[model samples]
Target: MSKVDFDEYVKEYDELLNKNLSFFSKDDSYFCRYKADLIKQYSSKNPKRILEFGAGIGRNIPFIKNAYPESEIYAYDVSQKSLDYLEQKHPYAKVIREFKGFENFFDLVFCSVVYHHIPVDERQKATNDIFSSLISGGEFFVFEHNPLNPVTRKLVERCPYDEDAVLLSPGEMKNTAKAAGFNDFSVKYYLYFPPALKISFLEKFLRTLPLGGQYMLKAIKR
Candidate 1:
């Protein structure tokens, strides 16, 4: 699907996902807190330029902005509705046109929950786009579904993602990041509580543990 249409679908879907995607969002939600922590850990060095691909409803922007208030934040998506919402939520943001060529323009590029939507043939191109856009020594942080989790794998198939969309095993995630020209790659699994309990206490407690239900990958461009 075109990015514009994809964005539109999510604008209508954000609420549904917020309620349904329990493993990813509980209390502060994995993405919210993860982005915040990422900002705290990495933004201190002050990356002046940032870009977010498939930034659905602009959820990560507020937290990311907290750390880099002065940095220019660029959001890109295919959905006009979602982009409209993003623009409304983040007036300071600049919406990037499609295929803007991210080469060496961003110190940090955030792509969350998007790879799975790409077709198989396009997955490498997407990775290449991310790689080409990052500056040498830049960082790309991805938080994706773990195929190792049987439940997650099944849920992904049911989701409105492209057929090529597949969950990534820890090793697969690391290897893909490396192939994308990112080094010092690390993958951490998260979200390991029963979905019945949608509270932050469990998430906070579970996050302290090394293994969880979901997975996050941190890769640095070298």
Candidate 2:
């Protein structure tokens, strides 16, 4: 699949995303805050520096800031336009287009639904780069759509930016991180029910099920 240039979609990014995912939540921040909440609940480390990998358009910026207001936050993406939008919207986040002199720099690296957009062959190299950037014992939090879930598959099929998406399984995520030298890997499925069918209490019990619309993978650089 040919890579989609995100720069072209920076203008209509939010609209297009909402068109597809609005069913889950009318407010876009609902999805963004979910990741931040997961981080806060699962993480044991008080990172001095946090990195938002593939932070396109920075929807998560405010929530991340809310979660760690004092920690220095850095945003990185291949799309300059997306980075520009992120910078303009959230001045607190320092944006960078390239990874240079950043090894062992970040205490936590976060990625959300970004891996599917990456070309399959390049994923290993990208994972390796993330591994190299994190400080020893730093955590990497990655969230991705689970292709096993029919709803997620349909959403990806309908979204324009996801035209080239190749969804990865939970096993693939664990193995890829392992190959990149990540240890203590853990993964939990999410979005088990849509807005209407969702039962808050039962949701936690369903996290181990692999049929959720999405999954979160946590790994550490040990």
Candidate 3:
């Protein structure tokens, strides 16, 4: 797949979101709830500093802010337009294009649905940058589309911005983290059923199954 100019896509990003509001809302709500639970469960101590990698338009800011009210949140993206919107919408977050001066600074870094947009050849370098930005034992959370899921694949096919996306499987995400020198890692498959069909009990068991619409990989910097 060819690399995409994300800056160009940021112009129509909100339009696309409006068009697919229903579809996007379901995934967003599900992930936000899931992330809240995951953070409470995984975090050993209160995170004082947090980074959102590829934080386009700051979609994850609200959830992260509410989850960790005391944390200083920062957003990073390649699109100035997106960063502008994010800064306007979320004044609490500091936006940046480069990771300079942030080595071993963040206690946690969260990335969602961004890796697929990155070209395959550059993924390792991107992961390394993320790894370097984290403090030792700090956690990195990555959420990505599950290519094996038919629903996920179909949704990506219909989304215009996803044209340049090259979906990565769970194994690929683990390899990316490992290549970046992260040793303690874990992966969870989630969102087995859409919002309408969501069953709490069933979802619990389904997490073990890799057929969910999306998967999350957590790696701790060692």
Q: Which one wins on TM-score?
A: 2
Clashing pairs in 1: 3-78, 3-79, 4-78, 4-79, 7-79, 102-133, 103-133, 190-214, 191-213
Indicate the worst ten consecutive residues by lDDT in candidate 1.
1-10
Question: Global lDDT of each model?
Answer: 0.69, 0.90, 0.82
| Tens-digit lDDT track of model 1 for 15-71 | 556555755445545556665574456443467888888787788887777767898
> For residues 8-42, could you state the per-residue lDDT of candidate 2 as single tens digits?
99999999998998888777777888789888878
By lDDT, highest first, what's the ranking? 2, 3, 1
Error of 3 at 146 (Å): 0.5
The root-mean-square deviation over C-alpha atoms between each candidate and the true structure, in angstroms, is 3.7, 1.2, 2.1
TM-score of 2: 0.97
Off by over 4 Å in 1: 1-11, 22-30, 42-44, 157-164, 194-211
Q: Give all TM-scores, in the order shown.
A: 0.79, 0.97, 0.90
